[model samples]
Target chain A: MDPSEVDVPPLKDLTIDNITDNVKLINSQCPDPRLKYLLERLVQHVHDFARETRLSHNEWLAAIQFLTAVGQICTDVRQEFILLSDILGLSLLVDSIDHPKPADSTEGTVLGPFHTHDAHSEPNGTQIAHDPDGEPCLVLCTIKDRSGKPVSDVKIDIWETDSKGKYDVQYEGREQPDQRAVMHSDEEGKFWFKAIVPVPYPIPHDGPVGKLLKLLKRHCYRPSHMHFMFEKEGFDHLITALYLRGDPYETSDAVFGVKESLLIDLGTVNAEQAKTYGVKEGTKTIVYDFVLVSEEDSRKLREAKAMAAMKHLGLRMKLYNGLPVPEID
Target chain B: MDPSEVDVPPLKDLTIDNITDNVKLINSQCPDPRLKYLLERLVQHVHDFARETRLSHNEWLAAIQFLTAVGQICTDVRQEFILLSDILGLSLLVDSIDHPKPADSTEGTVLGPFHTHDAHSEPNGTQIAHDPDGEPCLVLCTIKDRSGKPVSDVKIDIWETDSKGKYDVQYEGREQPDQRAVMHSDEEGKFWFKAIVPVPYPIPHDGPVGKLLKLLKRHCYRPSHMHFMFEKEGFDHLITALYLRGDPYETSDAVFGVKESLLIDLGTVNAEQAKTYGVKEGTKTIVYDFVLVSEEDSRKLREAKAMAAMKHLGLRMKLYNGLPVPEID
Candidate 1:
């Protein structure tokens, strides 16, 4: 369709009233149909936002500088933009939208910035905490399919900060990984590990994201939680965290990665009971179960939901003279 | 006023529905009241834009990367972000909003990237074009106040590209500034200069902004025009351009800085008239007039208009619990 056919002000002598139209004109020239659509929508929104706030030139300059700093500070090991997104709750929002689980399945959260592909594989019930100064804790988790059947041979990667609230990666002098491990579920779909109870920690705040948090008068503490990634051949992958029930930051997690179902209680077990789990007496024990949905079912559900939402929003999929046209309200 | 008391969704377990609330929460922590208000409005608009487009994680990543590239490419002599803004028509939009001139006064346009603070001061009718290959043109301009009285001793900084459409700064081997001169108006408010007629030229296209233009299927040509910055002790400063009437790119100026009143005809002059103006026979001569408003009057009018607009938008200036509160719609 001719973009000019739409009701828009003249591009010449452009003012705030016609800024969106001028942007749309540029967007219409994009070679890729999907890119064109996305750019057009982006232009409309950005222009509207500027007009609504009557954004000053100085404010816009500040934003540009802030974004530039965020980009310049980023490296292979550091992703400040992602951190910015997480703190603003955008990362979690996107995660939830992209991974809507069934009622009985595990919910997903942010992958965070610390995950690595080199987690050391360990045997069941092996101790992951090499530092003896940490408090001993025993973790036992089960994995199951939607039918309540055990899902064997599944990989579970777990990582967390130590009792002092420092991840192994955060240490400048450390050369080896600490307090993290990868384990395979047993025939019974059960895996056990001995480690220190994870502690609440602040995200690295020396960067632009940290500066932004300080400016916002907000703290950078995330609730104590164990990061878990579960994967198998036929099931959908899950990147989530198990939060301790009583952590002070649980309700005010800086990244907002918490969900009601992800919070679990850690019970104290006596020596005799702990001995059975290969840990000392008075150790904390966490027992939790995770359910997985089939990959095919998950994909179908996501597509169906997205389609319904688009329809509800008055968007239609149609072709206009060989161009893909998204009729949006 | 207490921000929490405002009608907003909870930030916890933030979904797209609560994204704006989370943004507002961050905005509320701003120490400056004006900053707080601006940030809140910005958050609302940005969040709305994201939701309206249903922006994906990958799309967001692409945008972040694009902005980073634009920032990284900027230097003391180069401003890719400003170019991006100009091409997107945002710069012109902001200029128009900030400078609302009276009907009788000359309109303003973009200052562009070619302006420098070190233009060489020259006498009346000085030849600015040192290159012997260029076509000689004579320029005569008059400056006056809204009352039709001549405004003497007004400084006018004039700059333009050479006949080949290359600015002196664009040359890699050139060491001295070319085709630029600063002059003052005579007792009759008349200023004259001899230079080459500027040719339409393309903006620097090797940078990220250029790449974006190509991706948008748009050219990078700006219409041939002479930039002028007029300043007087008691009058508001004016930055504008005088466009050659028949340039092919006049209607499609890449920066959208053109206004109807800025277009002027360059007439051919005979040898006698050209010699009188100290140029060769068959030389082109441009005659134009500019009017300025008093600085004090301009400031008062601008402030009054802004106040009225703010009032009409349901924004009020009041104190809430001893703190300044701007109630915006």
Candidate 2:
């Protein structure tokens, strides 16, 4: 239909008082209902943010320039936008909201920018460290269902930075898939791999996200931890990390990915204990167990979590009923 | 101080319950107190927006991708980010906040992307329309101060689209400028020029902003209006528009630029009146008077406005004492 032929609603003068209505009118023509809703909510938030801050035109222009720089800096190998989200603590917040685990199941964290599909599958207990300049470490883990039954034949993807606190991808001329491997749980739901102990590392700070962090006077380091992703046929996929206990950054992870339950002790092993894992003396060992929720249980948990969030938000809205709330038809 | 040498505060795991604290920690290092405050406020609003919408990871990714595209599409002549801001009503909001007018002074609208500094100066009453296909229009205006005193020798930069509803820049292989000129008010603060009545025009929508507008199902037409920028020493610069009263999009400008006070009547002129202005009969004529504010008065108004905003925001914060309020120090 011709928009001009139909009676279009009069556009309100763009003022702080009518910003919400103007946004709604502009978005009224959205063909997709979901997109319309999202746009409407986004518009209201953006307008409110400006009003709350009494944002200046210069500040608005600065934001535009910063975002433009972020886009210009992005390439196939780099995603500055995602990095911005990570540093803003948004990545972790989205992860928590999307992956609400049952009491017995492993809690999820951010699927950081480093994970890749090209990681080669390696046998259980295979050595993952290539240039072993750091302390030798052995990682052992098991996967079990919420009912306490061993979940065999599960894929576990493990990755971490090298001893010097640099991912292989960060090197200029490094080979693909360094310090990363995909391992499957054996018949007993057991998996193990050899690698250097992970260390706190700064995220790539040479780009716009890094510049923003510096301007904000915030550090750019993620805590010492090993990223893990577990998947099986009838269970919810879990992406998590095992943060090393006592690591300085463990308490202040830049991405806010750490959880108390996810922290594990990194114990020093004697020669005899090291020999059992076919490693030299003074090697470090970390053992962790992950519980997976069944798909049905996960769905139920998500529903309950969403309902709770709605109730919570509803209560909060009552406290500020005078504030404009976007109509969501 | 070396961040590594000094004992740093422990990082808290990112959670909904601790989002406010996490934001504070991230901004702890900001050297500029004002920037620190802005960042903290920005972080709170962003997190709250996500929670209010229950924004999903997929939705967040989509936003990241969209912003990246907007940045990527920008060039020397094209600014997709600004267009996005205009469509979302942010440009107008920012303009309104920054250019608050007194009761007697003219109000400002959006400084659209089409504005250029390359317009050449012409004598008062000079005809701006080089090619005469459009209906002839005669613009007559006078400039005065808030005290009703004539303010002469002011530079009046005027621009509008032609009969075909396209700017010179929009036409491929066109001249440097068309239908745009800078005129000086006479000793009596009177100015007049000859041009065509501007027709409604669409904003450049072939780019990312246009694509977004299409997705949102909103039309992209701006109402017929003539842009004016008045400048003189010791006076606050005025940027405004004289919108035609009966234009179809006058009530619903795509950029939300229309104000009732800015609208002017376009009346038909008789042969005798046309001869007086040295124009043909049946020409359209528009007469308007603009009021300027002194720079000192503008400064005082801004100070008062800022103080009022601070007081208002303080009161609002009291209503949400339970919510996270960024620490000022």
Candidate 3:
């Protein structure tokens, strides 16, 4: 589209007070209402931030250079941007906003940058732990609907760090997927596997995001948690994790992925009980049940949440609702 | 620093409502009071932006990817981040905040990304134009202190685009600088040069920032302007540009660099006038004067501005001022 043909009024002599308004005026030409609204609010917040902070040229340039370094460091195996977001708490915030769940439903958390598509598919009783340094554990879980009915054939993907707090992907080479597996629930909505207990780990801190954490004087350690993803034909796809109770970093998780409801206690089993669960006598065990929300139910809840969010944003929408679409040829 | 060593409170079950506060709490460990304040405010604004916009997971990922691309595209000679800042009005906003001027003093504008340190140094009245396709023009300029006294020996750097709106640096494999020169003011506080007439041109639009502009329906053209930088002992270094009057984009400069007081008009010169100015008969002419402020004066104004800006930000500082700094061993 030609600029001269834009419907925005001519803007002249933009000072600090007026520049934001002029910017909004020009960007208001965007044909998509949602994008236009997003840009308008984004500009307002950033401009207000600059004004309120009295951000100096040097400081602003420092931010620019920092962000540039963060982008430059990103590779296929490493996503420095997502790590940056995770550290900033934006990743969790977005997860909460996008996937609001019912009180009884299993809570969702950050899908973090480490999840990959290459995990081995296995039966429920298969052992996923291959690291000698890790202690063995048995995971027994049941998948159920909101009304507590069994939901069979649910695809459950589980991954975790070893005793030393490293995932399989973190290793440079010499690895079939260890400490991670994908399995299907039985007819009674049951799934069980043997793996290493997860340990608290620090996020990748050798990049620009790490530098920022150091400057902020914050640690980059996430509490020990097992990653889980659930998919079924009629249920809302779930991306979540289970945090271990009594972990030292639980209260101060770097990514803010910890939830009280998601916390579970690890139990030790006697020889007979361990044999029945199919793990060694010294192995740790956890028995947990996950509740899923149906697609129709998820849609209804999302519509309600979206309505509330729209009301919160109604003022800006109302202001632009009257804007005339420029006559375009 | 170890997470256990930090004196921040234990944050548990961080919901969307409390994630921002938790982030600030963690970041409050910053020893530097000013940096702590900046991070606190930055987190507040960004988190607020995300919440207020109801930013979705996919949208957030898009933003992350866009920023990564912008950072990845930057090189030693080209700064895509600065370009992004420029088009967003952030560069100009920083310039205005950092360099406040008295009413009689010349205003400062954004130092755009096209500037280079490799311009040829030349004597007064030397023709800097090398492009045969460009129209010849004589630029006469005088520099003075705010008191109207000639300020001799001022370092003046001037650069402008050719008639086609392309800078020398934009061309690949160019050996010599065209229409750009670095010169000093004479004892009489006078300097002159010959260059091609600048034309309104689109900013580099083949990059991520350009894609953003296109998405926002904003035209990427900046008004025709001549870039200038002036520096001398005891005076505030000035980075500014002159916008030609009546340019189609003058009112809507892409970088928001146009100010009413900085607008200039082009004049036609006769054969005798051209000969006196050491230019051809049909040459265009621009005669302008620049005023500079003393360093001491600049400091005073800056202090005043800083105080005002602080008052604008006083609420946040006040909230944090009483915050107890956690005792650390």
Candidate with best lDDT: 3
Per-model DockQ against the true two-chain complex? 0.31, 0.44, 0.53
* Candidate 3 lDDT by residue in tens digits, B188-256: 899998887888999888899999888887888988889999989899889999888999888878788
- Docking band of candidate 1: acceptable
Which regions of candidate 3 deviate over 4 angstroms?
A171-178, A269-278, A309-329, B174-178, B270-273, B309-329
Clashing pairs in 3: none
What tens-digit string does per-residue lDDT give for candidate 3 at A60-151? 98998998999899876678889988888899988887677999999999888787788899998898888888877788899999999989
Worst 10 residues of 2 chain B by lDDT: B316-325
Instruction: List residue ranges in candidate 2 displaced over 4 A.
Output: A5-7, A25-34, A121-136, A153-157, A162-164, A168-175, A267-283, A315-328, B1-9, B117-136, B152-157, B162-187, B190-195, B231-233, B267-281, B316-328
The residue-by-residue lDDT of candidate 1 on B199-267, one tens digit each, is: 788888888888877777777788889999998888987889999877777767778887889998888
Count clashes in each candidate, considering only residues at least 3 apart in sequence or on different chains: 1, 4, 0
Ranked by lDDT from best down, the candidates are 3, 2, 1
lDDT of 1 by residue, A1-329 (tens): 22223232234566657767876875586776767776776667566555544555556667766776776776555677778877777677666555668888988887787776778999998988877777788888899999999999999899988878887877777677788889999999999898888788888788888887776666787888999999898887888999998787776677888788898898777777666876667678877898988888776665565566667777784433322347541
Kindly report which residue pairs in candidate 1 clash with one another. Answer: A271-A281
Question: Distance from true position, residue A159, model 1, in Å?
Answer: 5.2
